[model samples]
Target: MMREVLTFRGKATAGTEFALGVAAAVVVLLLWEVVARLEFVAPQFLPPPSKVIAALWTMATTQHLLWHSLISSLRVWVAFLIAAAMAIPIGILMSSYRIVGAPLEPMIDFIRYLPVPALVPLSIIWFGVGEETKIFLLWLGTFFQLVLLVADDMRRVPHEYVEIAFTLGARPRQVMTDVALRSMGPNLVDNLRITLGWCWTYLVIAEIVAADSGLGFVIWSARRYVKTPEVMAGVVVIGLIGLITDQLLRALHRRMFRYL
Candidate 1:
């Protein structure tokens, strides 16, 4: 069983996969701890996981960690939902009709390539240092890329499906909504899952400029004070949150697309 698990491209049970993942994480953490204790890296710069965990506890108790986490999570979700809502329809239209896509695609392509951080100043000037600014930055980071992805997913829907729907007397709109969009459902969800991760990656950039009361702000504050443990703890929290959200989305995809 162990040999099979180690073999390239070999199948493994769910439990075996889970155990392997956990074992790998444990090994990495142990090595990190050893490196920290042996002073290979200064403890101030690379605190052991134990100290990081302790710092997490301290922040949770004294620094309104839950509140900050909630704030950050709320910002991410709100921006992501808005991006998804807008991107889906636009993406569908663009892919379903060349007239809609022709002029729009080039502009979207250009805007999406522009760095989000480079636009931070404009975002701050436009929205000010407030919730709107953070949300805008987060939304900006996600929307353009997601729009393209959504369009690509729609494109991947077989033209035969559209032809069959048309043969059945389905209207043009019906062919789009019922055939193309429905066919793209699983892939759309997967695209969203990937985009949500990108949103999280932009969180700190959104909050770092001029903000308060989010996980990013917490990390930035700790850094200014040279509290390495706190900084690491905050990063770990963001990573853990991202991991959990990703797993939830994966489970949802599996359940919803069981046929696939």
Candidate 2:
């Protein structure tokens, strides 16, 4: 009977927490609706939540804007995945070999600071204002940061782990694969979560440089036509998508690292 009471109390606490979160969201939405309807702020500049939702519904029915936004997001995801594939291995290799890392360090630092959007003209020149150029820009934006992150994580692994592996008659490859890599896994996953946020900003910047279609393009094109509601809708979509992706990554991390 005591145990049952404790369980009931625990559930009640969780329910209270959930209720508070829902109430907070509702209050914010109500405030926004009230302010917009009262014209306390310009509706054109700050459309109410209802207007944004209406715009989304109308756009969904009339145009493939959402489809285009998804395509743009997919491009960013694919490019980021490719960048990670290339960066992680190279980072591991660099961390394992001091000499290799030394020579590349300066060059990597230089390029990492360079603004990716500044390469738009050159990218178009090379890849010709197509999807390839956009993807390449996204890759360039994400690759250096990931490389640095992975390499840094690899370096932070305790030397004792490597020593233990060696004492157990493990080869260098075995030490890296079994000990160093596993140690770095959590940090790498965390960096990926952080990078997912960066990818949203990079995708918009990339699309702005050269794109006939995309969420960024939608926002940009809508601004030109003075479609403030559409622009607000696009902004909302971007935020929702970014939040969804972040949640998914968080879930993946929790699932994979449950033991940790």
Candidate 3:
């Protein structure tokens, strides 16, 4: 007889999963609150959840926090899309042809290792420290790594699959378009999702140089005034925004790869 997947994990509903995730977050917050209340850590250094919420509420009502958050989110998405557009085609080209991959891989890797922050001056000179510089910073952080990720995913497709396609009289173009790209679609989506997180990581760095708006700007400004609660609030906003986008991507990935 075949065994049934009847364990707790196997039997979990979406509601149960959501509840568990919420519970885990609640537990962490409770612990942090306890520490803050007991004065285990200084309030100035580690504000409690209530204080952070109050700070965030003040910003929302008085300082246009939503607009700044939206600007930051737009920057992230624009940069991520640009990076994906540049990286995916090149990744496919490199993975498809050893002649192409061998020569260019070294140059790309070399540039990737040069820290993004080091490029801030160059980007400011080139793009004039406006939106372009910020977006470029976000792109630089994500593109090189994403190209490698997509290429690696493509290369991971089994040679046997390609051979099987060829045996069935599939043309090179058809094999690449129908088989290779399709096989890698789910993985590519996952790659985009992962790299989106990387794009968010660059936000503070991007906005710090000449920014007047963005969550990063808010956090940086709060820090200047020693507004620990406001800084924490801004950090929490970034985390929540990231969490939402991450989950959205994961949901889209699951929808795209349901057969898997």
Candidate that would win on TM-score: 1
Q: Is candidate 1 or candidate 2 better by TM-score?
A: 1
Candidate 1: tens digits of C-alpha lDDT, residues 82-187: 9999999999889878999999999999999999999999998898899999999999999999999999999999999999999999999999888888899999
How far residue 230's Cα lies from its native spot in candidate 3, in Å, is 1.0
**Full-model lDDT for every candidate:** 0.94, 0.86, 0.90
Clashing residue pairs in candidate 3 are none
* lDDT assessment of candidate 3: 0.90
The better candidate by lDDT, 1 or 3, is 1
- lDDT tens readout by residue for model 3, 147-172: 99889888988888888999999999
| Alpha carbon lDDT at 255, candidate 1 | 98
Best candidate (score: lDDT): 1
* Predicted candidate 2 versus true structure: per-residue lDDT over 1-260, tens digit per residue: 33543684544456666776798999999998998889988878878889888988888778787787788889988999999998999888888898879987788889999998888889889999789998998899889988988889999999999999999999999898899988888889989888767878888887877888889888888889878889999888898888888899889988888888
Give the Cα-based TM-score of candidate 1 against the true structure: 0.97
| Residue 57, candidate 3: C-alpha displacement in angstroms | 1.4
